[model samples]
Target: MSWDDPRPMSPHLQVYKLPITAKLSILHRGTGGALFLGLILMIAVLVSAASGPESWASMHSFLSGFFGQLIIFGFTFALYYHACNGVRHLFWDIGKGLDLENARKSGIAVLIASVVLTLLTWLIAAIV
Candidate 1:
Protein backbone atom coordinates (compact mmCIF):
# COMPACT_ATOMS: atom_id res chain seq x y z
CA MET A 1 0.00 0.00 0.00
CA SER A 2 1.35 3.44 -0.98
CA TRP A 3 1.37 6.33 1.53
CA ASP A 4 -1.15 8.22 -0.59
CA ASP A 5 -3.53 5.27 -0.70
CA PRO A 6 -6.39 5.12 1.78
CA ARG A 7 -5.04 3.50 4.94
CA PRO A 8 -6.91 0.72 6.67
CA MET A 9 -7.93 1.64 10.17
CA SER A 10 -8.90 -0.49 13.12
CA PRO A 11 -12.45 -0.38 14.37
CA HIS A 12 -13.36 2.20 17.00
CA LEU A 13 -14.61 1.30 20.51
CA GLN A 14 -18.21 2.05 19.43
CA VAL A 15 -17.94 -0.49 16.63
CA TYR A 16 -18.36 -3.44 18.97
CA LYS A 17 -19.95 -4.23 22.29
CA LEU A 18 -17.67 -5.89 24.84
CA PRO A 19 -18.68 -9.12 26.53
CA ILE A 20 -18.81 -9.67 30.30
CA THR A 21 -15.40 -11.27 30.56
CA ALA A 22 -13.88 -8.52 28.47
CA LYS A 23 -15.53 -5.88 30.62
CA LEU A 24 -14.30 -7.62 33.75
CA SER A 25 -10.78 -7.76 32.35
CA ILE A 26 -10.87 -4.02 31.80
CA LEU A 27 -12.26 -3.49 35.31
CA HIS A 28 -9.47 -5.61 36.74
CA ARG A 29 -6.86 -3.30 35.26
CA GLY A 30 -8.75 -0.21 36.41
CA THR A 31 -9.10 -1.51 39.94
CA GLY A 32 -5.41 -2.24 40.04
CA GLY A 33 -4.74 1.41 39.27
CA ALA A 34 -7.23 2.56 41.91
CA LEU A 35 -5.54 0.36 44.48
CA PHE A 36 -2.23 2.05 43.73
CA LEU A 37 -3.80 5.44 44.48
CA GLY A 38 -5.38 4.02 47.62
CA LEU A 39 -1.90 3.15 48.85
CA ILE A 40 -1.09 6.85 49.01
CA LEU A 41 -3.98 7.31 51.44
CA MET A 42 -2.67 4.41 53.49
CA ILE A 43 0.75 6.02 53.64
CA ALA A 44 -0.78 9.31 54.74
CA VAL A 45 -2.53 7.60 57.61
CA LEU A 46 0.67 5.94 58.68
CA VAL A 47 2.65 9.13 58.51
CA SER A 48 -0.02 11.01 60.43
CA ALA A 49 0.12 8.45 63.19
CA ALA A 50 3.87 8.81 63.55
CA SER A 51 3.77 12.60 63.35
CA GLY A 52 1.82 12.88 66.65
CA PRO A 53 -1.65 13.56 67.95
CA GLU A 54 -2.43 16.77 66.06
CA SER A 55 -1.54 15.28 62.73
CA TRP A 56 -3.33 12.10 63.59
CA ALA A 57 -6.42 14.05 64.61
CA SER A 58 -6.54 15.89 61.31
CA MET A 59 -6.13 12.68 59.33
CA HIS A 60 -8.70 10.92 61.47
CA SER A 61 -11.18 13.74 61.03
CA PHE A 62 -10.79 13.64 57.29
CA LEU A 63 -11.19 9.91 57.26
CA SER A 64 -14.34 10.19 59.32
CA GLY A 65 -15.97 12.69 56.97
CA PHE A 66 -18.61 11.60 54.43
CA PHE A 67 -16.47 12.28 51.35
CA GLY A 68 -13.49 10.51 52.85
CA GLN A 69 -15.66 7.55 53.80
CA LEU A 70 -16.94 7.35 50.23
CA ILE A 71 -13.38 7.22 48.90
CA ILE A 72 -12.48 4.56 51.43
CA PHE A 73 -15.57 2.56 50.47
CA GLY A 74 -14.61 2.73 46.81
CA PHE A 75 -11.06 1.71 47.63
CA THR A 76 -12.36 -1.24 49.61
CA PHE A 77 -14.39 -2.43 46.62
CA ALA A 78 -11.44 -1.98 44.27
CA LEU A 79 -9.21 -3.98 46.60
CA TYR A 80 -11.69 -6.86 46.73
CA TYR A 81 -12.37 -6.77 43.00
CA HIS A 82 -8.68 -6.83 42.14
CA ALA A 83 -8.07 -9.74 44.51
CA CYS A 84 -11.02 -11.81 43.29
CA ASN A 85 -10.12 -11.18 39.65
CA GLY A 86 -6.51 -12.12 40.33
CA VAL A 87 -7.72 -15.43 41.70
CA ARG A 88 -9.76 -15.98 38.56
CA HIS A 89 -6.69 -15.32 36.45
CA LEU A 90 -4.77 -17.82 38.57
CA PHE A 91 -7.31 -20.47 37.68
CA TRP A 92 -6.83 -19.65 34.02
CA ASP A 93 -3.08 -20.03 34.45
CA ILE A 94 -3.70 -23.49 35.88
CA GLY A 95 -5.74 -24.42 32.82
CA LYS A 96 -9.04 -24.25 34.68
CA GLY A 97 -12.17 -22.26 33.80
CA LEU A 98 -10.89 -21.61 30.28
CA ASP A 99 -14.12 -22.56 28.55
CA LEU A 100 -16.49 -19.77 27.55
CA GLU A 101 -19.25 -20.80 29.98
CA ASN A 102 -16.89 -21.13 32.92
CA ALA A 103 -15.13 -17.91 32.04
CA ARG A 104 -18.42 -16.00 32.07
CA LYS A 105 -19.52 -17.68 35.29
CA SER A 106 -16.24 -16.82 36.99
CA GLY A 107 -16.45 -13.22 35.82
CA ILE A 108 -19.90 -12.86 37.41
CA ALA A 109 -18.70 -14.66 40.53
CA VAL A 110 -15.81 -12.22 40.90
CA LEU A 111 -18.14 -9.20 40.83
CA ILE A 112 -20.58 -10.73 43.32
CA ALA A 113 -17.79 -11.85 45.61
CA SER A 114 -16.21 -8.41 45.55
CA VAL A 115 -19.47 -6.70 46.54
CA VAL A 116 -20.32 -9.27 49.22
CA LEU A 117 -16.87 -9.17 50.72
CA THR A 118 -16.76 -5.38 50.76
CA LEU A 119 -20.17 -5.16 52.44
CA LEU A 120 -19.28 -7.83 54.96
CA THR A 121 -16.06 -6.00 55.82
CA TRP A 122 -17.87 -2.71 56.41
CA LEU A 123 -20.56 -4.46 58.45
CA ILE A 124 -18.00 -6.14 60.65
CA ALA A 125 -16.15 -2.87 61.12
CA ALA A 126 -19.37 -1.18 62.13
CA ILE A 127 -20.26 -3.92 64.60
CA VAL A 128 -16.86 -3.96 66.15
Candidate 2:
Protein backbone atom coordinates (compact mmCIF):
# COMPACT_ATOMS: atom_id res chain seq x y z
CA MET A 1 0.00 0.00 0.00
CA SER A 2 1.14 3.53 -0.72
CA TRP A 3 2.01 5.83 2.18
CA ASP A 4 -0.83 8.15 1.22
CA ASP A 5 -3.33 5.33 1.06
CA PRO A 6 -5.59 4.74 4.10
CA ARG A 7 -4.67 1.58 6.00
CA PRO A 8 -6.79 -0.50 8.36
CA MET A 9 -5.82 -0.27 11.98
CA SER A 10 -6.04 -2.93 14.64
CA PRO A 11 -8.61 -2.60 17.41
CA HIS A 12 -7.64 -0.48 20.39
CA LEU A 13 -7.47 -1.87 23.92
CA GLN A 14 -10.55 0.12 24.91
CA VAL A 15 -12.49 -1.52 22.09
CA TYR A 16 -11.27 -5.05 22.75
CA LYS A 17 -12.26 -7.36 25.58
CA LEU A 18 -9.81 -9.83 27.08
CA PRO A 19 -10.81 -13.34 28.09
CA ILE A 20 -10.52 -14.58 31.71
CA THR A 21 -7.35 -16.55 31.07
CA ALA A 22 -5.71 -13.59 29.37
CA LYS A 23 -6.66 -11.33 32.31
CA LEU A 24 -5.35 -13.87 34.79
CA SER A 25 -2.08 -14.16 32.86
CA ILE A 26 -1.61 -10.42 33.11
CA LEU A 27 -2.43 -10.52 36.86
CA HIS A 28 0.10 -13.29 37.38
CA ARG A 29 2.86 -11.10 36.00
CA GLY A 30 1.78 -8.14 38.12
CA THR A 31 1.64 -10.21 41.31
CA GLY A 32 5.17 -11.44 40.59
CA GLY A 33 6.39 -7.85 40.67
CA ALA A 34 4.43 -7.16 43.86
CA LEU A 35 6.03 -10.18 45.50
CA PHE A 36 9.42 -8.65 44.82
CA LEU A 37 8.36 -5.56 46.72
CA GLY A 38 7.03 -7.74 49.53
CA LEU A 39 10.48 -9.31 49.84
CA ILE A 40 11.94 -5.87 50.47
CA LEU A 41 9.41 -5.30 53.24
CA MET A 42 10.32 -8.63 54.74
CA ILE A 43 13.99 -7.67 54.77
CA ALA A 44 13.17 -4.41 56.47
CA VAL A 45 11.36 -6.27 59.24
CA LEU A 46 14.28 -8.61 59.68
CA VAL A 47 16.78 -5.78 59.83
CA SER A 48 14.70 -3.88 62.32
CA ALA A 49 14.47 -6.91 64.54
CA ALA A 50 18.22 -7.39 64.40
CA SER A 51 19.03 -3.75 65.04
CA GLY A 52 17.56 -3.20 68.54
CA PRO A 53 14.43 -3.04 70.65
CA GLU A 54 13.71 0.53 69.54
CA SER A 55 13.94 -0.37 65.88
CA TRP A 56 11.88 -3.49 66.38
CA ALA A 57 9.23 -1.55 68.23
CA SER A 58 9.04 1.04 65.46
CA MET A 59 8.62 -1.62 62.82
CA HIS A 60 6.03 -3.39 64.88
CA SER A 61 4.08 -0.21 65.36
CA PHE A 62 4.00 0.47 61.64
CA LEU A 63 3.05 -3.09 60.90
CA SER A 64 0.19 -2.88 63.39
CA GLY A 65 -1.26 0.24 61.80
CA PHE A 66 -4.18 0.18 59.34
CA PHE A 67 -2.24 1.15 56.24
CA GLY A 68 0.55 -1.25 57.03
CA GLN A 69 -1.93 -4.06 57.64
CA LEU A 70 -3.56 -3.23 54.30
CA ILE A 71 -0.22 -3.53 52.53
CA ILE A 72 0.47 -6.81 54.26
CA PHE A 73 -2.96 -8.10 53.27
CA GLY A 74 -2.32 -7.17 49.65
CA PHE A 75 1.09 -8.79 49.80
CA THR A 76 -0.45 -11.93 51.21
CA PHE A 77 -2.94 -12.04 48.36
CA ALA A 78 -0.19 -11.49 45.81
CA LEU A 79 1.86 -14.29 47.30
CA TYR A 80 -1.00 -16.78 47.14
CA TYR A 81 -1.98 -15.65 43.64
CA HIS A 82 1.57 -16.02 42.33
CA ALA A 83 1.87 -19.47 43.83
CA CYS A 84 -1.51 -20.68 42.60
CA ASN A 85 -0.90 -19.31 39.11
CA GLY A 86 2.56 -20.90 39.06
CA VAL A 87 0.93 -24.28 39.63
CA ARG A 88 -1.47 -23.54 36.79
CA HIS A 89 1.49 -22.75 34.57
CA LEU A 90 3.11 -26.02 35.61
CA PHE A 91 -0.04 -27.87 34.52
CA TRP A 92 0.07 -26.02 31.22
CA ASP A 93 3.71 -27.02 30.85
CA ILE A 94 2.61 -30.62 31.22
CA GLY A 95 -0.03 -30.06 28.52
CA LYS A 96 -2.92 -30.13 30.97
CA GLY A 97 -5.55 -27.39 31.31
CA LEU A 98 -4.50 -25.94 27.97
CA ASP A 99 -7.94 -26.29 26.43
CA LEU A 100 -10.36 -23.35 26.59
CA GLU A 101 -12.70 -24.91 29.15
CA ASN A 102 -10.00 -26.14 31.47
CA ALA A 103 -7.99 -22.96 31.12
CA ARG A 104 -10.91 -20.78 32.17
CA LYS A 105 -11.75 -23.08 35.05
CA SER A 106 -8.14 -22.99 36.21
CA GLY A 107 -8.11 -19.21 36.03
CA ILE A 108 -11.20 -18.96 38.24
CA ALA A 109 -9.77 -21.51 40.62
CA VAL A 110 -6.59 -19.49 40.98
CA LEU A 111 -8.54 -16.38 41.96
CA ILE A 112 -10.71 -18.21 44.47
CA ALA A 113 -7.76 -20.06 45.97
CA SER A 114 -5.75 -16.88 46.32
CA VAL A 115 -8.47 -15.03 48.19
CA VAL A 116 -9.33 -17.98 50.39
CA LEU A 117 -5.71 -18.67 51.27
CA THR A 118 -5.03 -15.02 52.00
CA LEU A 119 -8.00 -14.76 54.34
CA LEU A 120 -7.16 -18.03 56.03
CA THR A 121 -3.61 -16.85 56.63
CA TRP A 122 -4.79 -13.64 58.24
CA LEU A 123 -7.30 -15.49 60.34
CA ILE A 124 -4.70 -17.91 61.63
CA ALA A 125 -2.28 -15.10 62.32
CA ALA A 126 -4.92 -13.29 64.37
CA ILE A 127 -5.66 -16.45 66.31
CA VAL A 128 -2.02 -17.14 67.10
Could you tell me every candidate's TM-score relative to the true structure? 0.89, 0.92
> What's the lDDT of the predicted structure labeled candidate 2?
0.95
Q: Which residue pairs overlap in candidate 1's backbone?
A: none
* Angstrom error at residue 83, model 1: 1.0
Off by over 4 Å in 2: 1-7
Error of 1 at 44 (Å): 0.8
Clashes of each: 0, 0
Kindly list the per-residue Cα lDDT of model 2 for residues 2-121, writing each as its tens digit.
Answer: 768788767888998999988998999999999999999999999999999999999999999999999999999999999999999999999998999999999999999999999999
User: What does candidate 1 score on TM?
Assistant: 0.89
* Most lDDT-accurate candidate: 1
Clashing pairs in 2: none
Q: Least accurate stretch of 10 residues (summed lDDT) in model 2? A: 1-10
